[model samples]
Structures are given as C-alpha cells and as structure tokens.
Target: MTRAYLAFTETGLALAKRLAVALPGSVARCGRDGVSLAEWASAQFVHSDALIFVGAAGLAVRAIAPHCKSKTTDPAVVVVDECGRFAVPILSGHLGGANDLARAIAAVCGAVPVITTATDAHGIFAVDEWAKHQNCMVLEPERIKLVSGKLLAGQPVYYRADFPVMGTVPAGLFLADTPEKADFALTLCPTGQALHLVPRIGVLGIGCKRGTSAETLEAAFAAFCTRYGFAAQAVTAAASIDLKQNEPGLLAFCQAHGWPVRFYSAAQLRSVPGQFTPSPFVQSVTGVDNVCERAAVLDADGSLFYPKFACSGVTLALACRPFAPDWRWQNA
Candidate 1:
C-alpha cells in the first residue's frame, strides 16, 4: 500500500522520514511550498493508500473535512504530533485499516495508538471488517450499520455461509443452516435481505455477436444474474475469446461495471478439458465449439454453475471457484 506523508515542520519531517521505514511506497511532502492543504488532501484522497499527517489533530481534521467521503472508499488517515506523543487514527479504522496502521506507526515512533471503533473496543463480530479480511465483495454496503449496530447492542445476528468456515465463529454471530434462519448471508448467490457478503470467487464467461449493442449486452447481464440467482456485483473477472478483446460493445459493458475482461485464444479455449455443449456454427467462426462454457471454467478450479445460455444476441456462462473463510486469519 502507498502512503503520503505531509509534514508541517522540520521536526515533523524527520519523524516522517522515520515513519517511512514502515511503508515501502510512501512519499513525504513538506508544507514549505505554501500549497493549500485542502487541495493537497483532495488530490491524495484519489490515489494514496493512506495519509499520514505529522501535525496537530485539528489541523488534519480541518484539511480533510471537505474531502471526507465514505469510510468504505476513503484512504486510511492517521495523525501524529511532532513530538511523537500519540498516533491516532482519525478515519477509516476498520475497513480501510487505519487502526492497524496507527499501531504500526506507534511501534516505530514510540507513541500510544488510540483505537475508538465500537466493535474493536468491545471485541464483537464486525461483519464489514471480516468481509474485507475474507476478500469478499460487500453487497448493500449502506446496511452495514444495521449488522454492526445489532452486534454492538448485544443482539444475536444469524448468518449463513455457502462455503466452509475454517475457524471459531465470532461471538454474537450464529451460523445458520439456511437463509431463512439468518439475518445476513455470506454467499455469491441471492439472499433474503439487504445484508450479504459476496466472495469474489465467481468467473463470468461471455460470447456475443460481432456487432451487438452495449445496451443489449448490459441488459442481458442484469437478466442473467437475476434469472440464475447470482449477484452481478460479485463477478470478479469476465472471460472471452481473443477475437472479442477489442470488441467495442463488450469492452464498454464490462467497463461500466468496473469488471476487467480476460481474453483467451481459441486454442486456449479448446485446450480446456471438460464436457461442453458444442456448436458447429461457433466452431466454424471462432475455431472453438464452446466459448462461454470453456472460458468460464478454464481458470477456476470449480465446476460451471450454469451451462451455456443465449439471450439478447449475447451468450453467457457462469462458474465459481472454491472459497473458504477463516475467522482467525485476517488481512489486517
């Protein structure tokens, strides 16, 4: 991760240099240029992984006030005084990993790290933090407060995971056998309510006509997810033949959803071993009998959840990779 160190004084600059030993790809900047701190913070928020302010806590707060967005997307922010008395995480404690970073800074600079997140303070089950640790895509991010609130209030929250749980389940979260018995879910498929965590273990394979419209392709994508009980937001990679790599319509569709398309040559698709519903017409054109089915399962070690299906001038297939969640192992 990258960090931008903004030091206000020469003493703070020296501390910034010492703190730089912890972060590899970090840049330290001084305030001698008379640049606006607000504008500086705005620019750093877009690309910086974390922002370290070596100044007063109120100064850091005022500089980042307008640039502060959601805790989910914002970069980790920490403030440390020039004397290195305390390292406090001012924003994005859990999901953005500011709390852990503050402790690391404190260890390096010999400062006290102050953590104030309710879930961490009480040692409860934080669904959002666990989801990020598991590399799962959080659906209904707005509803994260509901799960956290329930846990903080000492209320029982039931959850269902389609995959295997490898560690001891955290307190306040019960593992339910079915979705009907749960308050939230941990799966890529559709669940009952708003709180659900989708693991990024799904592979989406696509095959479409040469000149299909982006609108048609997008509509087909939404419908495909709805009809097959899958969440469109859970797709990690979009696979297709090499010929469609430059296809304008396909590129636009994936780009709109922030999904990168993975292109495989016809030979690569053909080399994939498994049962496939071959199409002679497709083979004559692209040198592969099955593009969608072959592309989906080739990179994933799991089976194809859906066979080749055609709709809206676009052919699609869905496949899943094996996912295992361990409560003890966190990316933090």
Candidate 2:
C-alpha cells in the first residue's frame, strides 16, 4: 500500500482528521508547533508517498522540500489550507500521489483536487504500472517516463529481444530476435549452470553531439546500460540514429548491435505527432533534431511508449518486454 502524511495547524489538523478517514495508508500529524511538523514530516518521508501539509499550503511546500530525502523517491507532498478551503498536490503526482490523494482529500474535506499529470488525467496505463501488471521487472525503474514520454511524443516501441516470445507487450512491440522456437530467454543468467532467468528488459538509445567517436559512444552505451540495469542481450532494438550521421555515437551503437539502424529524418520525427517536453540537449544534438523523439518514433511501431534516460552526453530510450511467468528449471 502507498503511504501518506499530514502536517497542519489546529484548523488544518481538523481538515486532515476528516480526510484521513478515506486514506488507505497511515497518516500522521504535527501539533500547532511548526517545528514538530518538519520533524514529523521528515520521519514520515521514510515511508510515505503522499504528504499533505494542511496549513498555509505554500509555506508547507517550502518547509517539506528541504526535508525530502531525494526528489525522485521523496513522498508526494500536498498542501491544503486550514478550514478545508483549498487542496493542492505539491509533488510526485504521477509516480506516487497527487491524484488519488487529492481526490480522497477533496471527498473528505470538501475541497478541490488540483491534479496535473497528463497520463493520469488522460487515463493512460502508466508505464510503471503497466510493467507491474505484466510482472516484468523494471530494469531502469527511473526510465519509466521514457516510455510515456515517447508515447506522448508519438513513438512506437521497437522491441527486439534475443528470442521470440510474447505475452502482453504493448502495441507496436517488435520481436527483433531471429524467428526461432523458444519458450523464453534466460533473463537472470544464460549459463547452463543457472536455473532461472530473472525478470529483466533493456531500453537502448543514445544522444551525442555531432562527431562523437564510436569508441566513446560504445563506452557511454555500456556505462549507461550498466547504470540502468540492463544486460546486452536484453536490448530489444537500436533506435534509429538521428539524421545527423556525423554522430559517431549513433554509428557505433548501430555497429555494436549488428542491426540496421532505423533512421528518422527531422521532418519525419516532427511529423509523427505527440506531446512530450523535448529536452534542450535533444534539440542541440539533432541540430533541430530531437534524438529521443526521433529514435522512439522510429522504434515505436504503435506501442504505448515512454522515454527512460536523460543524462549528460546521452539521451537514451528504453524498450521493454513482459517477464516470464514461470521459472521452472529445464535441462537441454
């Protein structure tokens, strides 16, 4: 179950008391003293996903920001003024809270739930939630957005695993491995000595300035993949190189994968429509070219997708497959 916390004054605490009735997880409160609110909120941050600060909503946001452990993992922070006048979801709307929590607060406290996550508003199966549904382990858990971003930007998921097997992958999912008779690929380890394949997948793509050397590109790819928890074989497909072939990183990625690099021209990428906030570097690397946008558009045949990586020197994308349902040992 997801966790939540409530920090508020006397009136805010009153509103919180009513709102807490509907919350599924635990909720804690700070007394009138603001000092305790910070301490209580900090301790609760360890386990909560939704934090509702019920006083001066804006001040609550500022107070909680400092105590948040890490932005990514930090619990969702929301602010609702005393008297149940206004409800505002301050942080982590999509991954953890903001929507459901706001709705619950609104229902209990008679306030408005101001939510802004496009996917949630639009009823799209969140990439992270979808992965969980398929029982596929999230390789780069952080890259969950890469899939959604790509889909929002109008890209199909081009997937190529080491083998052919499908259970419930999204639309436009590609089976790039050779046509062969196989139940599943070994995900945990391929060695005969091992018995089970761990639930695993990889999203591979790249971002580089014009003229990045193939060697440097390969190193970056290797490092990125390792950092993101992917085995080389788990890579489904090499996303199309940006139209700029001058990019050695793109070329090197193609050569290393031993696959025909799918190239999406700028016009084609821009033409394939969707709504993702393109990164500045993507605009820079592609020279009016969006590397991830173009790559994902070319890769995604028609699958619900998202972009996973956004780091210096590399703008990578992730393509995933469903994890194996059963892991019985087999002798060949």
In the range 1-332, model 2's lDDT, one tens digit per residue, is 36555645566555666667677555556654344766776776776666777777666766677775543466777777777766777776644545556666777778877766665565453554433333343444445566566556666534323333444554433333532322122343333221122343443545566566677666766665666554565565566554655556567667777755566666666665555446666566554445664565456543223464555555666544443442111111
Per candidate, the number of residue pairs that clash is: 0, 20
Candidate 1 TM-score versus the reference = 0.91
Estimated TM-score for each candidate? 0.91, 0.44
Candidate 1 least-lDDT 10 residues = 23-32
lDDT of 1 by residue, 135-185 (tens): 787778788889889988888888888788887888888877667877778
| Alpha carbon deviation, residue 306, candidate 2 (Å) | 31
Predicted structure 1: lDDT: 0.84
Error of 1 at 193 (Å): 2.3
Best candidate according to lDDT: 1
Steric clash count of candidate 2: 20
Q: Candidate 1: list runs displaced more than 4 Å.
A: 329-332
